[model samples]
Target: MKKIFIVFVGLCLLIQSRAIADEGMWLPSLIHKLNIGEMQKMGLELSADEIYSINNSSLKDAIVALDRGSCTGELISSEGLILTNHHCGFDEIQTHSSVDHDYLQDGFWAKTKEEELPNPGKTVSFLVRVENVTDQIVADLTDEMPFAERNASIQRKSFEIQKEATEDTHYDARVQSLLEGNRYYLFVYETFRDVRLVGAPPKSIGKFGGDTDNWMWPRHTGDFSLFRVYCGPDGKPASYSEDNIPFQPRHHLPISLKGYDKDDFAMVMGYPGSTNRYKSSFGIDYTMNETNEARINARAKKLEIMKRYMGSSQKARIQYASKHARSSNYYKYSIGQNKGLSALQVIEKKKNIEQEFATWANASEERKAKYGKALELIESAYENTQDESAYEYLVETMVRGPEIFYFSYGAKGLYEALKQDNQERVKTNAEQLKTELDDFFKDYNANTDAKVAAALMEVFNNNVTPPYQPRFFNEIKYKYKGDFDAYVQKMFDKTLFAHRAELEEFLNNPKLKTLEKDRAFQSALDIFDLMSVLGSKMRETKADLLTGRRLFVAGMMEMYNDKKFYPDANSTMRLTYGTVGDYIPRDGVHYSYFTTLKGYIEKEIPGDDEFDVPGKLKELYEAKDYGQYADADGTLHTCFTTNNDITGGNSGSPVINGNGELIGVAFDGNWEAMSGDIAFEPELQKCINVDIRFVLWTIDKFAGATNLIDEMTIVK
Candidate 1:
């Protein structure tokens, strides 16, 4: 009751305050109680129930969580025409692509429903309901309870509640903590598995400007892909089958060709992955120096090696396209975030806020009792875990960096199965491993991986101390004579995992001794053994850090009742609204809210993969075939900017107008605000979206996929 009262009062205060432009990733279920009045004042034409309703068809019906929340997508037609970002579907596209067909380079368009490509394991989910369960969860907790005990009780209660709620349904339920465990909510979702690819533009359009313009504004990338949801004839979730039919959605979004103007109301609803808006200054410092820095450095090396191979071979280019993009996207983002953290003086700002909070806490004995030790605990935890930087490097370089080493880690399951001496289970596991390896090797290049292994191994040796070095390094020093390159070459030569034929032969003649002697497998075992030792040593400090953060967050909320607060994103569906506006990132640098086809043409560099404009697109531009998708000024809008709060998983989220009509697809955030995941910069943060009109133009005119265009409800 106390926790509920605090949240309720917070909501009342939030409703009375003037709203900031790009501040929150709000829960949709609480909109009427927390945001509707302000939203209506900002030009919203729909009621709260119209946006989110469990018992009726509403805007929430159109939205789907792609692949259980790696990204977001929307139903654009009654027959389940799903629209999501190209990168979100990059894996599926790559899996289906071949050297001869090259769907990635040439694109694919299913003229008929029968031609749509089936994607196994791919799924899209819709939120069925969000229920407040704070009172129920806290009913068993007391203020004097120990942290571990309280956490255990909460988890036990949440499991019981979720199990009971989802007892007989196909729906999935998760109990997520809000306000850092002070509040709680249960989100229920209905997931569909039989999703199929319908259409995609070539990389020349879909990934225009490629890595060079990934998180940049004034962009022209047509980063959209088409998929469809299929279900059983009875209209329930079903496995992939030829017998499955396209799902008839309860509601689908009407795309508005009525383009938005600057300052026009905009709202985005999607699963935002994460944000640490309440992070302490010490935590921010740790992220800047240790986590992000290690990631950026490690990924940079891998990207360079991948780019070298990709640049040389057309096959390698297609194979590693998605891999390179994924690595580079965050590599650049980390660099930008470090710069933003420094340039924005975020640490100083955080310190000032901490000082203010401390002053207030010390002013009252009760406040001091609650919050006096929060910041101290956070600082102590950070200090105790200062040595984690080396571990982070090991994780980034040894575990996540080298392709061969990572692949070898999978052998642990096989090793365990072999020990069981169950011949039937062994064969079953071998076949399963073969299937996984087939998928892995489909886009794998051994030459590139060998280079990556050598480089990253050397980096690990140089950065980490002698005591911390994995046991395998001693082999390189003693047996290989300190030659990592030679060792890697021999491993690739002897390891059956490197080649399918060799692996198939080994699987047929199963032997535990062979795996034990294998250099690649041995290295994986050494790393795993060493990591386990180090992980145990670090566990206590990590537990302290988590507890400190939870307490610190609670303290802030309790002490600062005047300021409105929103919880950090945790890969749950949220709604954020603002306006279609631009910002001056710095002095003397004002950017427009929208970009047009002309800017795209001017930026094109022929024969260059990153900025190459397809000959057909160039011809279209020359002929001014803007069609009905163009603005009144006769310019085709490519992408636009909005000061809407969003993050990584918000990719492919529908950027809707006040009328609940899809106007654009949110794809990227401005580079200037890369630090937004840690701290929201209301003035600088902007959500970059691909104009829905451009998506339509590419489908109807450029791709000649009028059948797709005919299915959607297009509002002029």
Candidate 2:
């Protein structure tokens, strides 16, 4: 039977490559050919060219990729500051918050460098190299072509290898696709764009347990933040100037304050973003019945109409505090990833690894014509969950639940330049929608999006299926007869895209019958023509589910050719490593890896708004004051835990150690591995960091800010 299923997949790949040493995320330019000799026998005192070098300055230039990969920052000094996580600069501290500079309820310190703030479309990037171009993108493909002609010949040889690796560099490049497209790399980067901010703390100390301790654990939140970057006078990137400067980094992360013990080691490097550890089980039963049940039923009625307009004040809580923490961080991460994929059965362990790859592809006929219909073409392209459950309930109720149907679908490019009459392309798309109506009416509130468009149009007309509704739910069931709050209060009282001076006086006289008699631009053109007919019927079963997931990840990499695989997270820049232990998550329940400031004053509740507590962090925890950033058991620790393998763009990632320094920032994961981005529960995953001495004891003793503590290089 194909040599007894290749010696039962080489004894299940030698017991999953020796029970994963804190599983992989790797690729720091293949850590000197696959993890510097098992990270130098698990201690790794640097060297993989000092952690990735394209000819110098290493630790991948102090890891960045914030807005680009959506979170992860480090560069701890040589002036470009950085440090990341306070919910990844929670929308630039809720865009420099207001009720007279609230900085998300009191917090913000710049102390100089002209009291920092500027963050116009923030960016950070870095990376600068990584090659692999998988044999020049599968050298003119085959296996009889077509999967949209081998994805347009791997997107025209990845746009000619990212235009010859960024011709005449201002560097950006791309490529990506690893292991599902069976490898390819490139990367490049640089970015910058004046990022600013500088410091933050008071969402009760960077969001202390709000959303009742997000992704739980012994976490005490001080979830970091701070920023810097700048640049200009020939250093490079520019934009928000005033004659910029600070950008002097090629490697920064120093700050250790000598700490870390339980199995020490550790490591991280950032930009994690996505992970689908080889998906399947019909894509985790269509990601738990259609995209985490339509983002936990349209973000639980748009977070109860944005917590009733952010409790009707503090300027609607700084205009929906970063849109209610980005829709309650994935509506409680799809209710804890559908209770950790039904408590980790993980769709019966991906249906017993697709029934041991369909019994070793029907025991040969040349592996049954090269992997027989890869799990019957991924179970006939996920056996119809009716157009992927009405395209994930029209992308969680009208393309990411109300904000007036994608801001009146950005006036369909000024209604296709006023139906091609094109007066200079309708004055350049009406001066880019009047310069995006001053950052969309500065965090819009049209009555809290008209009660989130009448509670997500009654959760998409009682859960989709009227042939995927959206003819504005048959004009709200025949002209408001079904009311939906009087058809969303007469589509927000006759939408000139919900008044910002009547959409800048109808974009200074725009017409086409007043945008075809607007009602939020004809319900944003019937919600983008039913999202272009359900994205042309899911790109007709997405080219046979991308040729059965690139021939089932190339027949499980030629049936585990001596194991060693990695590649899933796609935001990119990887490196994982592990240690600072702690995890028992079950039976006798032992949890602690770290957390103190006396468990953030034993999770205080004085006047609770998710466990409040900040009378100057309860007067520096009743004066023990933790000066040299404590922790020799003297206390003040805050957060920690590791066994590394992170996700969600390794939120503010840093947690270094083995003499690489920095030691903690990674923000949240535990809750018994919220399906660790599709399975990698090495004993209930972990990551959850914060404690770099509770981020320098909240910038030197709760915001004394001591000129941002003498521009930090602090290793002591």
Candidate 3:
């Protein structure tokens, strides 16, 4: 009863001191107790139970976590049609593209369901429910327990609980810690394995401003794609099969054609990937100096090499499109994040907060004993940035930069089987490698990867110290006379993994001697070995860092008992509500809430890769052929901005209106708010969404994909 009273007081305090309406990403299950009345006051027409319910169909059933939270998608039809950002489905689109049929350059639409393309290993998970499991997880833990031991205990208890919840069911379950381990919640999901591509616009429309205008406002990108989910006869999750039928979902969002006005109510719900709003000043410094710096330096060189190769031929462009996009996206993000952090003075603000908290802690002996040393521990852990810097560089330059090294590492299983002289195991592993070869080599260019390897190797050598460098560097220095290009050329020429035919021949008749002499395989082993060593060296510091963070968060919750607090995002299902509004990004510079098709036409460059306007799209724009998809103003609005909080995994989240109708599809965040993951700037942070009407316009008028549009539930 005493504990219950404390919990109730906490709730009351949170409600009394709620921050700006746009500042939180809230869990759906707790909305009834914590936020429903506030949300209703802000113009929400639906009840909490209508948004999330365990016994009845609700909006939760219509949301999906594509590939388990890499991105979000929404169900638009009862036949399981999915609407997500084109970038979210880029891998599949690129995989099916070739010189003869370049879907990325030209749009693709399935005239019939039979023509819809299948993608292996892709999944879409629907959230079943969420339950607070704090007591079950931390009831037995004590303050005296070591951090490692406490974590192990939590993991064991969580596993037991998850097993019990998911036993005899096809649903998958996870127990995620929240508020820096001060809270815990269980999330169960029903995952479907067979998701297929239904339609996509050409790059000229879908990726319209490309990297140049990625995080900028007044966006004109038609960043949306269509997909469908399939299930077995029992309507359960199943592998891809010819006889599978389109899934029948319990609920789907009704698209709203009526356009929104400024300050109209808006909300977004999706799986936000991660954030560090409660991070210490020391942590922010480390991110700017070490992590972001390394990524920027390494990816700049790698992207340059890829761009040169991609411009060589049509096949080359199709092959490297997805890889280049993935690398360049974060490369630009890191640059923008550094600029925002400095402009916002985030580190200084964090220091002021820490000083205030320290003063509060020292006022009482009891508080001092419980919360003291939190900042000291955090500072000490981050004091030595060398090891962490080296590790970050190694990861960016070696592990992620070069494809050949990691691809060659896939044969480790076959190597182990051969060493054991297990013929059956060897046969199994060999066949597995053979199966993966087609996919890997289909997109891989040996010359391109070899160039990438040389550039990235030079980056690692220049940035990382001698002691932290991978052992393969010794071979480069002595055997290859310190020329990265020479070393990479020799390795590519000699390795069987570089080409499909050579690797297939070796797999057909495997031998231990041939594998042992392979230069690429040996280098892969050394690279991973160094990674393990670096990881082990950081374990103690990592443990201390986590302990300090957890205690600090707990102390802050008690210190500011009247303040509302939200947990950091960790790829969990969350809902954030706000309004469709514009803002002053800088003094004397006002930005509008939305952009129009006229801006897209004005930005077009003839024959340019990023801004090239499709001839058919130009014809329609010249004719003003927007049809019924245009707004009341008789113009097509391309994108709009909202104040709702979101992050990386919210890429394709639905933007819903007060009446619970889909208004837009979220795709990016404004440039001025790149530091939002650490500290939200309500005045500058904006959720950039592609207008739903523009999505419909591109489908019906631009592509004439009426069959695809016919299945949707549109509200005009």
What are the per-model C-alpha RMSD values against the true structure? 3.5, 23.6, 3.7
lDDT of each: 0.86, 0.83, 0.90
Number of backbone collisions per candidate, in order? 0, 2, 0
Model 3 residue 538 lDDT score: 87
Candidate 3 lowest-lDDT run of ten: 8-17
Pitting candidate 1 against candidate 3, the one with the higher TM-score is: 3
CA RMSD (A), model 2: 23.6
**Per-prediction TM-score:** 0.96, 0.35, 0.97
Q: Rank the candidates by TM-score, best first.
A: 3, 1, 2
**Decreasing lDDT order of the candidates:** 3, 1, 2
- Show the colliding residue pairs in model 2: 179-183, 273-649
Residues 1-716 of candidate 2 have per-residue lDDT tens digits of: 66544333321221134456767788898879767877778888888998888889888899999889988898888989888888889888887888998888888988897989888888898988888988989988988877888898899999998998889978889897887788889898989899889889888878988887898898788888889999897889888879989899888988888788898889898989898878787888889878888889889889888987888888887888888888898889878888988876778756767777778778889987988887788789888868778878888887888888787888888788888888788878888889878787888888888888788878888887677887777877887777798888887898888788877887888887888888878887887888888889889988888788878878877876766788888898898887998889889889879878877888888877667888887888898888888988798888889888889988998988877888788887877778878777777788888888888888888888888779888977
What tens-digit string does per-residue lDDT give for candidate 3 at 540-638?
A: 699889888888889989986766677889998999999999999988999999999999999999999889999998899899999888999998899
Clashes of 1: 0
1 against 2, candidate with superior lDDT: 1
Off-target runs (Cα >4 Å) in candidate 3 are 1-19
